[model samples]
Target: MLPKIQHLLKASPAVTALIGAGTDPITDPVRVYRHGDAPQGVVRPYVTWSVPAGDVENTFDGADADFFRVHVDCWSDGDVEVEQLAKAVRAALEVEAYCAGYYADERNLETKRYRIGFAFDFILSRE
Candidate 1:
C-alpha cells in the first residue's frame, strides 16, 4: 500500500514540480518515505506517510478487501510551500483513495519547518 502511494505521488506532475524528480526515484527529491524513515538532511518539501490503522473485511464467503487509514505529511521550509505540497499529495492520492481530510497544519518550532498532515482511506481488493 505504501509503495502504491509512493508511486502515485512520484508520477504526479504537480507533485514532482514542487518536490523534484531525482535522477534516482528511490533517492530523489520527491523523497517519499514511510514515517520516521527519511534520512537526515533530506531535501525540503518532501513527503512522509504511515498507516496508523487498518482492517480486513470479510464476508460470509471470505475476505474480500483490506482497509487502511493512512496519514500523509508534507514538510517544507515555508508555509506556502508546505500547503502547495500537501495539495499535490492530496491530488495524487485522491485518484485512487478517499481523502478523510487534513488533520494538521503547523510549523515545527525546533526545525522551523512547516508540516501539513492529512488522512486517506484505502480499500484494496484481496483478490
Candidate 2:
C-alpha cells in the first residue's frame, strides 16, 4: 500500500515539479519517504506518509476489505511552498482516496521548516 501511494504521488507531474522526479521512484531519497524515515539533509518540499491507523472490514460473509487511514505530510522551507506541495499531494491521491481530515499547518522553530498534513481514507477490496 505504501509503495502504491508513493507511486501515485511520484507519477503526478504537479507533484514531481514541486518535489522532484528522483532518479528512481522506489528509492528516491529526496522525493518521498515513509513517515520518520526521511534521510538526513533531504531537500525541501518532500513528502512523507504513513498508515497510522487501519482495520479489516468484516461482514456476515467474511472479511472482504481493508480500511486504512493514511497521513501524508508535505515539508518545505516556506509556508507557500508547503501548501502548494500539499495541494499536489492531495490531488495525486484523491483518485483512489478521499480526504478524511487535515492537520493544522505547523512551523518547527528549531528547523524552521513548515509542514502541512492531510489524512486520507482508503478502502481496498480483499478479493
Candidate 3:
C-alpha cells in the first residue's frame, strides 16, 4: 500500500517537479518510508508512515476498504519551505482519493524545524 501510494505521488508531474528539481539537498524526491525514520541532516521534505488503521472488508467486492490515516511530515530548515511542501503533498494526494480529514503541524521550538503534516483519511479499495 505504501509503495503504491509512494509511486503514485512520485509519478505525478506536479509532485515530480518538486522532487526532481535537484536544485538543492532538499529538492530531491520525497523520501517515502514505511518505517518511523527520517533523513538526518539539513534536507528537503520527506515522508514517514505509521502502521495504518484497521481494515474493513467488503464481501461484495474483491477489495477490502478501510479508513486509513497517512501521516505526512514535511521537514526543512525554513518554515515556509516545509509549509509549501506540505501543501504540495495535500494537492498531490487529496486530488486522487477521498480525504476525510486534514491537519498541519508547522513547527516545534525544541526541534527548531518545520514539520508541516497531515493525516490523510482515505479508503483503499483493492482487488
Candidate 4:
C-alpha cells in the first residue's frame, strides 16, 4: 500500500523527485522529501507519513483479524501563497486518488499549523 501510494505520487508531473531514506542528515527520523516542480516555480513541500493504525482486531471467541491502515501527510514550509499551495495539493492528490479525474473532494482546514492553515487527510481503503 505504501509503495502504491508512493508510486502514484511519484509519477505525477508535478512531483519532481522522491527523497528516500538516509539522504538528509538534518531532517527528522522519517522518510521526507521535496516533491513537485522546483525550477518551474513549484515549492517542494515537506512530506512525511505515519502508520498510526496497525493491523489488529477485536477478540471474539479467540478470533483474529487483520486490517491495513496508514496516513500520508504533506505540508509546505514557511509562508507560501495559499492559492499555490492549494493547487499543489490538489495536483498531488488528484493523481493519488486513483486518478479521480476531478479535484473536488471534501477537505478540512486546521489553523494550528499556519496563519491560513490547512491539512488534507484522505481516508483510503482497498478491498
TM-score of each model, in listed order: 0.89, 0.87, 0.71, 0.36
Number of backbone-clashing residue pairs for each candidate, in the order shown: 0, 0, 1, 0
**Candidate 1, residues 32-112: lDDT per residue as tens digits?**
888635688888888889988998888877758889999999999999899899988999999989999888899998989
Candidate 2 lDDT, tens digit per residue, 14-85? 998988787775565447888645788887878888888998877877658888899888899988999899
- Model 2 has an lDDT value of 0.83
- lDDT tens digits by residue: candidate 3, 9-118: 67666655554533344446456656546756634555555545655667765666655666666666677777676667678787655555555575767877777666
Using lDDT as the measure, name the better of candidate 2 and candidate 4: 2
Query: Model-by-model lDDT, in order?
Result: 0.85, 0.83, 0.62, 0.39
**Root-mean-square deviation of each candidate, in angstroms?**
2.0, 2.5, 3.7, 9.6
lDDT of the structure predicted as candidate 3: 0.62
The candidate, 2 or 3, that scores higher on TM-score is 2
TM-score-superior candidate, 2 or 4 = 2
Candidate 2 stretches with Cα past 4 Å from truth are 1-3, 24-30, 60-63
lDDT of model number 1: 0.85
lDDT of 3 at 75: 64
Where is the poorest 10-residue window by lDDT in model 1?
A: 21-30
* Candidate 4 residue spans exceeding 4 A from truth: 1-3, 17-44, 54-69, 81-86, 96-127
